[model samples]
Target chain A: MLDDVVFWVLAVVAVAAGVAVFRVDSMARATYALAVSFVAVGLVLLLFDLQFLGVITVLMMVMEMAIMAIYMIMFMGMNPALMPMSMVHAKRPSLAVAVVTFVVLASGAVLIPWPSRRGAPASDLTVSLGQALMGSKMLVMMTVSAVLFATIIGALVLAVPRGRYDRLGDDLRGRVDADQPDGAGQ
Target chain B: MTLQTVLLVAAALFSVGLYGAISQQVVVMVMMGLELMLNAVVLAAGGFWWFLSPAPDGQVLLLVVITAMTVEMAMGFAVATLLHRTRNEDMTDMATDLAQ
Candidate 1:
């Protein structure tokens, strides 16, 4: 009873915010809508007893949104606050495609024969997860994480315009903060 | 809640995401759309794991999906940043040429 009600409420909030992501005028507002949408979805995940993932989702999204806000300021500095820009294109065709995709997916969700519910989960779900991570699944987890690290370095290299030569002296032996040409690092 | 109900919610979220992804011309907006779609998939997977299977494997898969989604957005933003820096533009239409 209560679960159903909460589920419906959060699900509606999530969907509403998802729609607002595009309908809103400013880019910052769209990011806020997306963050709200995910937070609602995280709550729904918690309602479904996915405690860890739900919390992680909330944390990760908050941080991600902060990064997005910074990105907005970093790149779109023309209007300062409003952005005063509308970037949408091919409105009619996109709307048609969206409507068709929604109808097809929603109909499939309603009509398809899904699998039956299995037995209850283990008493200690987190313990089992930890054990699996340290056991057979260890390699995959470790490799994926290593790849994630590599991607971080790669992304930084690709995105940042400055390097050791620009920040430090030509010998790469400049002081921590004072040796740059611009005196801005200090 | 029933599995069907959860699945329906996921579908709705995915559709909204699709709409945004298609209609938006800004690169970051498109990435946000993709994030929302991936968010729907994560929730749906959680629903199936909770209501249908109660399996640890599904949870693991869900985590992987989450990781992939995060990495994808990060990479996308990196590319957007690069494009903005060099080209001083961030619209999808402005980024049409690949031969550069």
Candidate 2:
């Protein structure tokens, strides 16, 4: 009974914070609201006995939100993210879509005849998870690592306005330029 | 406690995210919506694993989804940074042309 109560409470928190993400005026508030939502969801995962995933979710989401807050502030131009502003557009249609989606999904959840469990859970879930990663799912782990590396490289490439060659001369042996204005290289 | 109950929560979270993603004008706000949706998926995946399968494969799937969420957010921030730096615009309506 206590577990059920906790689950319900976390569910409310997760959903409410998600709603607040769009309702809040400032970018920082919206970002943190989403973070709260994710943390709540992580706690729910913990309730499900997914200790590692739950903990990782909490850590990753909090860190991601911090970085995202910085990016939102840095890129919003003239510090408008700090000021109150309308965060949404085409509000009516979006509301309609959201409502319809929720109704459909909720109905499906309630109406569907789910399958029964065929076997008991592993005694050591985390150990089994580690073994799976190192065993049958090894390829997936390798691919995900490659993808993460590529994402890091890709994001850096897209974000940096000045290339190495632009900093150093085309021949790659110029004095380190200093005190250049933004967009001066172009 | 039950799978249906967990799924109901996921559906609610996902719908809110859909609303935000469709309505939000700012790039980062849209990305927040996307993250929220992924957050819902994580919850549902955990619930499914606990109540139905109870296998390590489900955990692996959850890990992959979370990783994808991280990658997506990183790329989103990068694109937002690029857009702001190059065009001085952050609203989606202002960035109508990709060829520009």
Candidate 3:
């Protein structure tokens, strides 16, 4: 009973905050609203005994939002100007799409014949998850690690303008190379 | 608690995200919509694992999805910044040059 109540409450918050994302004028608020929505979803996951996944979701989203905020500030990248800007476009058709999707998915959820439950879950779900990752799913772990490394390098290449030559000397080698605001040697 | 209830919430979140992604002009807002959609998938997956199968496969799938979401969001923001730098604007409308 309590589980149902908590789930519904979190569900409402997630949906409301999601709606707020597009309704808000500023980019910062929209980002934060999305973070809140994800955090609520993460909490909901905890109810299912997915402790690692749930906690990681909250932590990951918090870090992602913070990075987004910093990028917005540093690059003057987002719609942070004093002049307000409308965030939404194409209203009517979008509403129709949303309503249609909800109807379709809700009906499918209700009407579909689900398969019978399988074997019981282990007493320690987190242990099972960990073993699966480091065990048979080692390939996925390795692939994800590669992807994350690529993401870091790719993001830096695209987002950062400076290079060794730019920050360092023309020779591409300076011990105390000077680049204001954001230089190396940190 | 029940699979049906969790699935309902997930579907609702997905639709809301669909609306936001379609209606929003700003690139960041669009990305937020996409994230919400992904979040809905995470919830539904968790619900499935809890009530239906309770298997390792579902848990692994969720982890992969979460990783994908993180990578996608970071790349999206980076691309948005690059686009904004090029034209001093981030609205989807400004991207019409390619079509023309």
**Which of the two candidates, 1 or 2, achieves a greater lDDT against the reference?**
2
Instruction: Please report, in order, the local distance difference test score of every candidate based on alpha carbons.
Output: 0.83, 0.89, 0.84
What ranges in model 1 sit over 4 Å off? Answer: A78-84, A164-186
Residue pairs whose backbone atoms clash in candidate 1: none
Best by TM-score: 2
Per-model TM-score, in order, reads 0.89, 0.92, 0.87
Query: Which RMSD values do the candidates have, in order?
Result: 3.2, 2.8, 3.4
Candidate 3 chain A weakest lDDT stretch, 10 residues: A74-83
Interface RMSD of each candidate, angstroms, one decimal: 1.2, 0.9, 1.5
Ranking by lDDT: 2, 3, 1
Write the residue-wise lDDT of candidate 2 on A1-186 in tens digits.
999999999999999999988887788888889999999999998887888889999999999999988877777744645688786788999999999999999999999999987677788878888999999999989999999999999999999898766777789776666675543343
Show where candidate 3 strays beyond 4 Å.
A71-84, A164-186, B98-100
Question: Deviation in angstroms for A136 in model 3?
Answer: 0.7
- lDDT per residue for candidate 3 within A1-186, as digits (tens), equals 998899888989988988887777666777788889999999998998899999999999988877766665554543563435575778999999999999999998899988878888889888998899999998999999999999998888787766666677788677754546667665
